[model samples]
Target: MNTRSFSFRLLAWYTCLLTCIFVLLCALLYLDLSRFLEHNVEQSQVRRAHQITDTFLATIGKTGPSYVAGQAKALYEPEISDRFVRITQANGPIIYASGMPKDGSFDPAEVPAFPPVSSRESFHRVKLSNGKTLVIAALNYHGPGKTSYVVESGALLDPAELNHLVLQLLIGLPVAVVIITVGGYILVRRALTPVERITRAAEQITQHNLSERLPVSRTGDELERLSISLNRMIARLDDAFQNSKRFVADASHELRTPLTILRGELETLIENARLDPEVRERATSMFEETVRLTRIVEQLFTLSRLDAGEAQAEWSRFDLAGLAKTTAEQMSLLAEDKNITIACDAGQAVVVEGDAARLKQVVVNLLDNAIKYTQSGGAVQLHVRRANGHAILEVEDNGVGIPSEALPHVFERFYRVDQIRSGEFEGAGLGLSIAKSICSAHGAEIEATSVPRKGSCFRVTLPLSKN
Candidate 1:
């Protein structure tokens, strides 16, 4: 069990509360039961004392005290029943006294004499020498001819039934607690199942799938309301994202015609032999900048299309190794300008399903990025291989590698490392972002890892074609 999880904490609190309740209930029950048993014992002694006073004491004057004693001995058999019975005249002598009980549980001689002048019946408890308790009840009565007498009756207080109850509670409490704990945990897990499902669904929803919504259970509870609220929030986010992509696509499309006219007019000016050399040079610089801006706009259009699921129109099976070889060869000319070496390792053919043109553009972007950052005499290597039912393409370069802080944002649109933001590196930072968007459209993943000043490696993994 994870102790920090919500379920664990809830169960811990529940168990603590349940244990406290059980203890409290058991304590109250034990106290109530003990008192009830003691009360019953005292009441029984009072009833026995009443029997002697009502039946035997009525005939004390008629038959005499000695006769009354014989009748008591014959009827009650106090010695056999473990009972103490005594009769005496008020402020006079004892009429009758019981002998030692058969069980010998307590000594009759240890019992104190009843008070001679007690106005009413009374009850008390006595602890005998044999570690037994006795509940004694005494009564004063007036007989015929104005004669008065006292009656006393008592019995040992036994705790056998209460002890059995305690023993049963001791044996059953732990088992009951264990059963309740297991059942409670299972219920908690079931209650949270819907939340877990919602979490997994939310994780799968990205910018590309902004239309997707979380599953909502119609349980008429708080979880149901929460899911509905989150879906509404996601719908708003989806609207914002779609609007942003539409704006980029529209702006890029609008700029294409003017950029083309600008570039063509600059070319026409440069080609005129009668133009001044300084004027031609200035036109050439503006032409280069216009071309760079044109490329950035094109890439923005491509990214917007990819985000709108419009880029994977021509899916087909193709050899990834062959594509890597061809793209590396084409980019080698660009590497040569910087005196950088380009190497292609395409020993084995790895077939994958995707738009071959888009994949080739990915290769071109990665090679171009490597060549731009690598120093003179540095090397860039491209390799394609098959592994675990996937085609892997790696473009590694011995270049001024990305800083650790900037590595994560390498594939983000318009994100450039601070080290490579100089005028010498002419780029708007959209190449890698376009490559990543293309890969995502083809159900592939791209990752970049770099150590500053050491090297950088970009790896693309795509599912191998079944054919």
Candidate 2:
């Protein structure tokens, strides 16, 4: 499935390298072997020619030149030898011709004007008019009474041996390549087995399992070093996660008690009969501020619980569509003040299993956001339906739309994009964060999509009750 994984890439590179090395080695071997075989043929031709000349010189005092030519002719054997031997005098008279071309294009009276021997013999490749190739070796021999004769021998350069070598390469190369490639793949897979284990272990590690560490190998190689580094990183993450949990717990305990006492004192002061109207009004304002602070603290507490996995959903079968409609009805009064229409489409009964109170809170928060952001006379629509065995809730408003850059962080805790409009819409930005936490606790998903100046839509999807 992961074609570009490290093992696959390594195997591919190994295959390519193997192919290059084999091809280069094969090319070098073929060239060397061909040269060696050609050299042997040339040497054999030179040796045979010299032997014939030596025999001719040894018998010169006993026999005539015609008799020596007759003796040389007797040595011709066409069946096993590829060489054609010929003896000729210096005056261009052919004395003997062995295995002459059947095409009769050769002129025996005119011996091939081969260059005189520079070393022991001279060799040249010659092509006959009949399209036959041969290597010709010539040796000019000096005999008795200052007489000279040329001993010339020819061997045909048949391509049978080269063809056999090419055939072996063509058949053997692919088999060798296949074997090497498979072996390379096996080696690469074995080498990366530890990485696979690390991958599976890493996948199982969520925030809930930050204490888990990747398995380390003792091979003292790169993989071992990688595992060690990864374990260190995981340990750091676990420490950070624990610290965050502790801070959240400590902050909740430190802040809530003071805010509650302040709100209670403000209530008692406002209720005093001796309190002046201005003093009572100030107390009321302080109470409101205390209440706002308490709500923000509670929201932060909820998010921390969600992150720490301390919150559990109280699952119950309920009509999700009915829940959306009730939330819309409660928020419709605020929409009315802005002359905006709040349309509820919770006409269908989509039964789902989730915490009813948390689900209701999600719908309420979404409707509240939609109503708050929508302009006067703009419309907000709440739609709930059962599609594909899931409950779908959508809240769409045609107001000043969210900017694209701010969309992704809209649900992050205390992240507000419309900083300039905070004066008018004043609050700690925890509504969306709380909604997202509740959704996740219910095994549901919530997503928002928006375009600048074109409004936004928040969609929540919850699974239907199995019953």
Candidate 3:
């Protein structure tokens, strides 16, 4: 469960995007509700003002100012109470007031001065210290004796509808988000299920199992298309690997018998008393080359079997230290020609279960490489020890060490470093690759480390035997 995995990261992105969208939608809803409430409240107040002004003007000249006021109050007082109402003289004296402070007064400055409304009253919202919201309107009103007055109407904001909108937002937003997020994760997981299956199948494949193909999906979507492509690639790789194994086996079998006969004939010819000295020397050189070719062919055959999983390890519990010492003693004779020192540290008996002959090949190859690369007067050391229940076999050389770039590919088949490829060194470059294959077949690991002009070290780790 990695929190930083692709699935979790995608979910995080979805959540952030959804949250922003949710907030925007919620804000838009709130604004629309506020606007609807304010407009409805203002329009209701304006209509009430029209009724009060018309009734007052109609009765004003037929009766007295006091009479008109009392009649206007009687007819429109109920309507005026729900919303606050006020009437004022042109000089700004309050003539009538209701649903406001009992003093029957409002601040004249609070009234917005707009051109007298011929058809509609101009409205504005005012906030009072008491935490009440009111929509106030000012309209022109004609009174008795050519006197004019301003009729101002106030309406309380409709809170019931706005509160409903608030409740909907508070309750619905979280529920919607939860539902959408859960659904998004499920959808994403379903979408990635093929990838997970592909990964699991790929993990099960190895060199021995290259023939296995990934399960191809038929959904015809991108994932399905990817699966088909990978299956085709794996099929091609399996074919190539099989062809390589077959070629090695076939070539090795074909060349070894002829080379054996050639060697025998050369040996016979060189031994003849009648042979010319110069011709004998040439035959000797040819014999040496034939021997090298035979060795390379045999190595290639062994590797082919290893790759095809036909080479079975003959496990035995043997003294690994003894094996190391014996291999070093044999390699020392080769080292002597270059005047290099070969030191062995195998005083302890570290026993391990493996094919002794194959393990011997591993040691021989490492020592061979060390001796070949080390300069005259250089040193090669072989140490066999048990560490953490495993046998550690180390071969170190003080020679022209591998360059940093060449170290990694030293064990790869036929991979010669640039210097070696320049004809300064003699090898087909199959020795380390063969050694690595042998180690792997025995369930062991071989690793190399080096520095330019410093030296190279090879370590082989094998599991210690219980016997």
Candidate 4:
């Protein structure tokens, strides 16, 4: 898991908070449990002290202190039971006291005498030399003859049970934390699944597919709202793109008639034998510019139609290798004018499905570009092959290769390499853009790669025709 991802961070914070709360609750429970057990032990001690006073000490007037001591030792057996007992007269004399316990858990001689009590009953805790805690409950007793005495009973506090509870909690805490952390991770992933879906859908909604919308979940949560908002944004973008394409198509159509008439008039003027030399030269220049403009306008119209999905009506299955071979042959004549050689490798037939005319345009554009950029006497090679169910076409040239920074934008409309913008190689820069639009309409991909000062290669991959 990525620690920087939202789900991981959320799970981390949740686990930390849960652990802190769990530790706090366990601490409080342990403390409350220990206090409850201690209170029960104190109550038991108080009951034992009352038993010593009422059952044995109450008979002091009838029998003697000697008889009471005999009865406590024989009946109660304080020493064997690991209990402490003592009795004192109102003045100061200690009448009865327990000896060392049978287990030797504590030395009874280390126990202190009970202090004088203002109330009828009292309790005290003492720490012995053996690192044991002793809880003593004392009661003041009055005999039948107005004889007064203090009765004390105590037992050592044993932490064995509380220690067992601590061990259990200690063992269970990590297990509980692990289980909760796993559960929290799962919940976080499920919660963010919609966002992930939205991200993937948004990535696919580029300018080519502006009409597509992200899937909207009807859960009425933030994810739903986000999807709806993104859909609205895409709708606005689609409208803007439609308007732009409409303007380009309309403008290009309107300019064609005027350009045609201007070219014809210039041709007629140039043919006139009586025209001045300077006027004829200017007319020829104007004619050339008009031809260039007309070509750009025609390319723009084609690109707009491709963008609008109007070029798919002429889909057909044809051999891609044959098409590449034919287009390379035709473009080679132009390459010869520059003293450039053209090589075509169409060894085997690789068939594909698309608008044949548009695919031909793509090949023509790539070949023209390679021939235009290659140095005189340099070579251009066109390769066609079938690989992994796709038809691959590559156009490579030993030209002044495009810079690495400009390779990505070479197919963008009107983008020209700054280094190669000389008048001799000047162009309106719409050929590659038109080719890329046509490729996208046919579900093909076009990419360029170059080694500066070495050569450049443009590759087109189209899915093979199943038929």
Top of the candidates by TM-score = 4
Error of 1 at 26 (Å): 2.1
Candidate 4 lDDT over residue span 1-467, tens digit each: 58898788899999999999999999998899989888888899889888888787887888888898888888779998999988888886788888989999888888777658789888888899878899888888877766789888889888998899899999999999999999998999899889999999999999978989999999998889999999999999999888988999899889989999999999999999999999999999999998988899889888878877876778888998998888888888999999999999998999899889899999999888888888899999999998998999999999989899988989989988884454568578899998888888888999999997789999999999998
What is the RMSD, in Å, between candidate 4 and the native fold over all Cα? 1.9
lDDT of 2 by residue, 1-467 (tens): 57788787888899989998999998998899888877887888888887887766456657876787777766655223545777777666777777544544443333356755546567887776657567778887777667677778877766678889989998999998999889998998887788999989989997768998999889999989998999899999999989988798679768988888888989999999999999899889989888988988887877777677644557678898888888888888888998989998888899998788877888888887887877788999999998898889999999877898899999988888789875577568899988998888777899999976678899999888899
Candidate 1 on 90-129: residue-level lDDT in tens?
8788889999999988999998874455567778788888
Which portions of model 1 show Cα errors greater than 4 Å? 1-6, 70-80, 99-120, 127-132, 270-282, 419-424
The total number of steric clashes, by the backbone 3 Å criterion, in model 3 comes to 0
lDDT of each: 0.88, 0.81, 0.81, 0.88
Stretches of candidate 3 above 4 Å error? 1-20, 43-64, 68-106, 109-152, 156-206, 215-221, 420-422, 451-454
The C-alpha stretches of model 2 lying farther than 4 A from their native spots are 1-16, 43-60, 74-100, 103-152, 163-221, 270-286, 329-343, 376-379, 451-455
Clashes of 1: 0
Query: What TM-score, computed on C-alpha atoms, does each candidate reach?
Result: 0.88, 0.76, 0.75, 0.94
Residue pairs in steric clash, candidate 3? none
